[model samples]
Target: MAVGQVGGLLPHVAVPSTMPAFLIPEWGLSYGEAGLMASAYAIGYMLAAPVLTTLTDRIDARRILIFGSLLNALGTVGFGLLAEGMVSAMLLWGLTGLGFAGAYMPGLKALTDRLAPGDSSRSVTVYTGAFSFGVGLSFLACQLIADAFGWRWAFILTGLPPLIMTFVAWSLTPVTPAPRAGPLLDLAPALRNRTALGYSFAYGCHCFELYGVRTWLVAFWGFVAASGGAPLGAVVVSALFTALAMPASILGNELALKLGRHRAITLVMLLSAAVALAIGFTAGLSPWLTLMLMLVYAFTVPGDSGALTSGMAAAADPRFRGASMAVHSTVGFAFTAAGGWVIGVALDMAGGVSQPGAWALAYSVMAMGAALGPVFLWWSRRSGASS
Candidate 1:
């Protein structure tokens, strides 16, 4: 499961970190256009999540995962060959997102369906945590491949991993029987359930902040370098930050389990938002200090990640796990799909990369998601969440 997820993220991040540099000169794209391409994956994810993930309740998720992998591989290859403008980039990356929707939640559904009761929280935390490392490799891979050959080969090579993962997962993982639960795709139970809704809503905020940071971190690093101090480069810094975040996800989940989920998420989200609010202005600070701050910020941002999913999983109706996940994914990824373009628009409005205020405003907008998290938690508590 972990390995397949790692493979899944490869195609997703293959372009975002490098696309602006590679395509801007060649395609004459603006920052907003570039940001749209970054958001395209999430757009595709939001579009496909409800149906694809819900179908796992009635069908083998492994089968869906294979189909998704095939779509991602094809999309990656298509991008390598066909991406020339913003439209093409968004369409192709959107396809990548659609493919991802299959692998992610369906894969989770598969794992949870098989696990014994009480075992899923720890298992789910590990699985969710793997996404960070997977993306770290995606950034590192894009950097190395682009340096060695060209930008296109990064997609071409990363694209193959999903195809390979499909076969490997098919052969190795247990074939979970499809759920006999009637109204397999109905989401009413989850929607009407406050505990489930709380986790799902919190996940939306998490994705809003998480994907926004990830999509723009590399470019933001470059802007920082140009503004004042240089810290290695965007690619290296992004990869390092994501790599460190892998451990933080698991640690955060365990901490939340010990500290109580509601308190942990509220504390972590507010603290992370505070750091995010401050981080944009630190570009002109000492390079080492800025880098350290970034590392800490990265840790804090993903700190609630595993906790959110595990919380939702714990709160979900057993018969409607797939449907609950569908709702969770749809709500979460909707903001993720919009995050990049919103930041770009904010950046342009604030006077592009030249003005420190632009970056600050844009990052603050992203941090708003985190800031809203505590509010949701409060509402959930007030509303009488079951979990």
Candidate 2:
């Protein structure tokens, strides 16, 4: 289950870290255009989530996995080969996002349905951990390939892993049938529920920060390196930060289990916001210090993601898990898309790379978003407690 889900996420991981730096220059794209490509992918995800979740209700997850994986591979390769302009890239990325929607949550549903009793949390942790591992590995792999070969090979090479995993998934996993009777998913009720809406708002804020940071971190580090007259190892630095984040994500999951999800999420968000705010003030310090701050920020920023998802899963009705996941993903990715655009506009408005302060301002906005997540989550908990 871990392998299957991670395979699907590999492309997502690779694109954010490497593609912005590598592709923007290679493809002659403006910052706004590049941002739109990223947003286009998330738009695709938003479109597919509810539709794919509904399909999962009627079909076998294993088959869905295979189909999704194939589409992901094809779409990723297509992006490398055919993406000439912003429109073409966005179209292909949209396809990639659609494929991803099918693979991620459906794979989890399959795993949970097949649990051998008393292993739900453990199974969930393992699944989420695999996702983080895949993301880190993909970043590392893309950096290596782009450094050695070129940017296009990064996409081409990463596509092969999911293809292989798709076959493995089909052979190992069993089919699952739809449930017989339940309340049909009505968006109105989920939207009206204060707890669900609060959780969704928190997740949106989290994604706004997380995705913006991930998309721009390499560029930000590169600016710092160039200004400091340091070596051009920004990609390597970015890769290291992402690598550190993988273990942190696993640790975060365990911390959430021990400390309570709400508290754990709040702590991590506070730390992340502080680090992001401090990075600009400390940029003139030694290179190692800047890197350390970035590493710390990356490690903590995404720490609460699985916890937020777990909270949503726990709060949802069993019959409506698919719909709940759909809504969660749609809102989260929508915010991510907005973040990408905001970062791009901020960069462009500040004029070219001449101003590191612009990047600082962008990150500060992201940090503020992260800081707000805990407030909404706390409000939700208070409402629940009072009720």
Candidate 1 overall lDDT versus native? 0.83
Worst 10 residues of 2 by lDDT: 180-189
Candidate 2 Cα deviation (angstroms), residue 200: 3.3
List where candidate 2 sits over 4 angstroms from the true fold.
Answer: 13-22, 172-175, 178-185, 188-197, 229-232, 385-387
Task: Compute the lDDT for candidate 2.
Answer: 0.73
Give the residue spans of candidate 1 off by over 4 A: 172-184
RMSD of each: 1.7, 2.6
Clashing pairs in 2: none
Q: 271 in model 1: Cα distance from truth in Å?
A: 0.5
Candidate No. with top TM-score:
1
Q: What are the clashing pairs of model 1?
A: none
